[model samples]
Target chain A: MPSIECREIYFSYRRSDPVLKGVSLSASPGEMLGIVGPNGAGKSTLIRIMAGLLKPQNGSVLLEGLMLHGLASDDRARRIAYVPQDYHLVFPFTVMDVVLSGRYAHGALKIFETREDRVIAGRVLKWTGLENLADRKFEDLSGGERQRAVLAAALAQEPELMLLDEPTSSLDVNHADNLMALLDRLCSDQGLTVIMAVHDLSLASAWCNRLGFLDQGRMNALGEPARVLSFDRLKSVYGDSVKRLDLDGRIVIAPRGKRNTNA
Target chain B: MLDMDKTRRKLVLACILGGLWLLACGLSGLLIGSTSIDIVRALNGSGPDAQILLVARLPRVLLAALTGGALASAGVGFQALLRNPLATPFTLGVSSGASLGAASAILLGLDTALLGSAAVPLFALAGAGLAVAVVYMLARRRGSLLSTNTLLLAGVCLAFFFGAVMLFLHYLADFGNSYRMIRWLMGSLDITDIMVPLKVFVLTIIGFILLYSNSRRLNVMSAGEEVAQSRGIDVDKVQRRIYFSGSLLTASVVAATGPIGFVGLVVPHVVRMFTGPDHRVLLPASFFAGAGFLILCDLLARVLIAPTEIPVGVITAILGGPFLVWLLRRQVEN
Candidate 1:
């Protein structure tokens, strides 16, 4: 059975046009699924829906053959963890504090942090290679370090499935590659299912086992990268001013010359 | 785990220190009223000192402590709920609403004609409830999403509206009632009957517990609402509880103290610098520290320029004003 499945999902903000229309997808263990799309193509919204953070106006989400929305939030969080794109980091909470916050599901009624929770958080921090920076305040970290810290916090949830929204938006090239590699390793090694909304098509194509191309609130393509990201498909969705090149057995798309001017 | 234990020890030690400081402040308040007194002789000997200490100063100190603790606790919750550090006990304009209620009650002759002195606090509480209800309704948007902007704007509008009503009432009152209303507005903890304030303080403590139970969720929320919701929190439910508790705590304290300022806005921030952002530690520690701070302020109000007392509100403002400037500048430099 699939770990998470969404059938005919539809969502819209109040009184506005639909942001998602009849979106259906599913993921199983030991796989990395990437949703790649232009800005405002309902990528983040879909991830939020899958995380059980939003109620779809229509359709349903199922996790491990059970209804997603039926379970309590803490129950859902135990199975699926979400890493948000934009963190509001208002206070100077330590990295340790940030990771320990994920243990709320483990101890909702307990006020103080327990030894078991500390051990788990420490293990996650070490796994994410952030053990050295555990004492540092969140605001004091570099961009890559902060991203890793948030990832570590989500890992503390001990989830079977992880959903990330634009996890590499704040990282440099090396950090982005490093993070994708780490996620890739985690998925295959631990039988973890990772579904991420990625803006970088090249990274998505290279790392993800399956890629879903979203355009104008609809899933245009979903399959292996070579099948889903055909040259003609890229031109049709992204317009005529793009070029696709096969570089060392990898499909790389680059913006060619000036922007498309006339209709 | 050793560090975890160390952290707990630090938190416990801090709370103990805060409790001790509050105790010291209470003792000092007894000693430093209008006239200094040696306590052992006063309690032992049949003198006016015993009456002065127990009847007059003790209740005053307790009330001051209650007011301060309640305001600071509410402030901490509101700040975390709204995710804005600038939030205070009065941020939602409940204090102005209470003030209006008290002012109108005084002017309407409710103090003498109907429920006697009890009527004023009753009316003020009603006004506070009205203000909270209106703001709560106005801020609500699209299925459980409470708009922070709307809450703030509605609060500001209510504050202005209530302030105008208060001024009109103040303008129309006769001189004797006018003096009474004015004194209540300036905030005095000097009440012969401490029963009403004590009950409100008890209610406020209950509210603090509700906030404390959600302190972990609040720690996650400080990262962002989305972050909190993603981490298994029922964001809407938690937000509603925190907002309700914060409003109740602030309203109860304002009704008792006639709108004490500075303690709400400054105390939580001051306590946070020491406690860091852990709401579990921050909540109780701020309560005690705030109590001590207000006791010190109330003592100064009494001791400075003896025989004639400065309004406690005036003392808070005079002291709080410069402290706010320093805080603002420091915030910018950081």
Candidate 2:
């Protein structure tokens, strides 16, 4: 199966200027592709469209070689899972309760969870290293735990394609790297295809197999990390005050250090 | 596994207990009254007890139980839709539209027309439908519905607009007619027509089943729209279903009972405290609890200051308002 593929997509909000313009990309299972962009670059918008949350104004999305438009939402959900930046629940649902909600498409008409659903939820929670906190209210968890809980929830969908929008924006460095590592492991071990919009360039470079630099509603660059984050493209897209360093075959892009007082 | 098992257990227990509670309240409504009827004679159909029980009390009680069940279910649905615990069945302007219809009908002297009693309910139902249509039109962006905030704002604004129209009508009416209008606005379940309860029974069954089946979808929505969609939910379709189903349910009950307040607002909260907000359990638990709560409230309306019966709406407000505060305090303390 080809997983999720977007073809020359275009989208705008309420007749405003287009947020995304003629973008085309395809991701396959066993790959982690990161879309890196500045604020207002439409990374989240693209991710949302791919997750089937928003309709692209032009062009099309295909899932597993079938048109995304024709696939029923329930069936699409069985194949794809999306993790947003934030998950806010007003009701005090427990961790297990939230995780089990991911199993919804398994039995469309089943109101209560079957034994199999429970078993899957339990396994996902453990896989996410959250078994001890399964009984706690989701709101009670720390920021990192909640993020993992959300990831665990998506994994419970048993999806072949996972789309995440700004998945680590609010996370601290330690938790952010941990979360990315988990995605990397899942892609290799379970053959899951991950498409994520990431703000931090170096982080995206570190984990993703392929990186797409999106700027001003357009895809400016798409390739391996070293090629995409070239010195010239980095200065042009991000402006001055940035540096790219290559150490031990790893590419790390960081802000210029100890610049003159006003330069 | 433990948490999942506990939720399943809670669902089963709530259904069994709630069914029993609904039955008990229904029987209490039939048996206990301000003018006590001799059950033996009433069942045998041989005395004035039969006339009093069948004609006056049975219909009122049946209407109360069904309306209570319906309002509470709608309340749960709205709270989930809005993702706010404070949302009520009337939070979206349906009840206000119904009130405006009843008030305008009274001003037009439909109260004294041929088949007058049926006029108010029919007008109220129409008004509720029209109001929902207006709110939907305003809340809809392009073709999709409810950005949630837009729906809530549009609904609140429509309620205010309809309420002003109702008040203006109330001001134009004569003193006696105005009194009738206000009494209807306060919501009462004094119908003598058994058919009203029968209609409510049918609507409640359909609405509850339609809503109950969407419990899984509602749970996914609790995690927000993005997460909900990735889980294979059509957010727009689900939102439309809840809005219409809840509006239809609340509309039917308001047409029959004059917009009984608080039962729809507080009963879900009370049940949520027990069932912990799983719609599968919260819905059924709230229905039974609300039905029982209203039956007792209505019973007290009859007997609390006997011979000068309080409005059932008044009873629910007085009890529900304080009970909600108490529940909030308990939750905070815990």
Candidate 3:
């Protein structure tokens, strides 16, 4: 069975309108699944539901054959770690302090971090290339560095599956590529399941083993990257003005210019 | 290793210095009340000095420390729960409610001998509890107490409403009663019997322990509610626990001593600057520092005008206001 599965999940913030409607996807261990969608397509809401932060009004999420909602919060955290899109720090906590907080689920109640907890946090920091910034204030880090710091914190949870919501939305090209490569390596080397929502279709096609395209709170397509990222599917979901090109073994989607449209 | 050692050293120094300061201030408060006492005679437990020391001064000083510590700890709890540096007992209208209760008691001429000395404090505690219940009821959305903005707005409105009621009571009271009511509203550290402070001490100690045990969870919460939940914290549960405990802590303190301001708002910020936002360290440190700070303020209130005692709350604001401004400026500069 897939390590993580969502069966016909449905959710809504209000009674009148739904944010997610009958969306179902699954991810096996040692694989990366990328979700691509336009704005307001319920990418964030879906990820939150998978992470157990939000409960779907209908259907269910299962982790390792157990109901995600049935598991206690700490138990769910032990199995799945979630990285949010933005983090706001109100006080000056060191980067180490921020990362060490990830071990909160593992520690005994009312107890502080232990020696083993420090070792794990340090390892994750080094893996994420944040060891040099350990003592620096979390608020002082750059955007890309902050994103990586948050990723490192998620890694410290030692979770079997990791859920990231638009993890690269704020990063520059180089940092974005570096983060994707790191995630790919962690998936292969550690046998971890990674499910992330990405805005960059090219990056999603290049790194993800499979892609799920969402349009208006419904799954429009789900398959291998090439099948899901087809020109006709892209044009239909995104609009008729969308076009794609295959370059360097990556599918790149772009808006059709006036000259190209006329031709 | 060196960094850890430096941190340990700093913590030890703060504890030692804070303990000594509390001791000095407590002694000074005992010795320098409205009337001077012979220290040796008072310590010997004989003479008029003994009567004043045992009956009045000692209980007042202890109450000041306990109330100060309770308010400060509750301040830290509120700030963490609301994720706002400015949150305090006053921000939640608990103190205002207590103030209204005390004023009403005084205006109505409630007999202390019949109701016991705790009549006013009990009334104040009930008012504070009612205010919190109203704020909670207003802020809750679909059975979840997750909205900090709604809570803040409701608390502020309740405060204004309670303030208007107190003013109307003052306007109706006779001149002698109005003067007494106003003085009580200004905040005092007066204690007639030792039992009140002893009871408050026990209650506040239990409150502080509960708050301390949840410090780790609070540390995670300071990041944000969603982030806290992702890390396995039950945000709603923590919010409810902290809110009720913090409000009760404030109520107990405000009930005994009329709403002593500034200590709750200022002491936590000062302690945060030194402790760097870890609640396990911050909460305890705030309690100690707050205890010392209020005792010192009480000492100043006693000595500033000699025979005519200034209100302790006035002294706390006058002293804490400029200091907080300076601290904020320094934080910005750094």
- Work out the iRMS of candidate 2: 1.4
Q: Which residue pairs clash in candidate 3?
A: none
Q: Pick out the ten consecutive residues of candidate 1 chain B with the lowest summed lDDT.
A: B112-121
TM-score of chain A of each: 0.96, 0.96, 0.96
Pick out the ten consecutive residues of candidate 3 chain A with the lowest summed lDDT: A107-116
Best to worst by lDDT, what's the order?
2, 3, 1
Q: Write the per-residue lDDT of candidate 1 for residues A1-263, one digit (tens) a residue.
A: 99889899999987899999999998989899999888899999999999988889999999999999999888888888999897758778999999988887877777777899999999999888999999899999998999999999998988999999999999998999999999999998999999999988888888999998888789888889988889888888888767777899897877776543442
lDDT of 1 by residue, B1-334 (tens): 9757866776798789999999999999888888777799788876788778877787889888888888888989988887888888888889888888888889888898423578788888888988999898988985778877788889989999888888888789988888888888888787656576678768888888888888878898898877777788888888888988988888887887788877877888878877788888888888998888889999998889887877888888788778877876887798
Per-residue lDDT of model 2, residues B235-257, tens digit only: 89999888898998899889888
Question: What lDDT score belongs to each candidate, Candidate 1 first?
Answer: 0.86, 0.88, 0.87
Off by over 4 Å in 2: A257-263, B1-5, B27-31, B36-45, B48-50, B113-116
**Residue A170 error, candidate 1, Å:** 1.3
Best model per TM-score: 1
Query: What is the overall TM-score of model 2 with all chains considered together?
Result: 0.94
How close is every model to the real structure, measured as TM-score?
0.96, 0.94, 0.95
Q: What's the alpha carbon RMSD for model 1? A: 2.4
Q: If you assessed candidate 3 against the hidden native complex, which CAPRI class would it receive?
A: medium
As for TM-score, the candidate ahead, 2 or 3, is 3
Arrange candidates, best TM-score first.
1, 3, 2
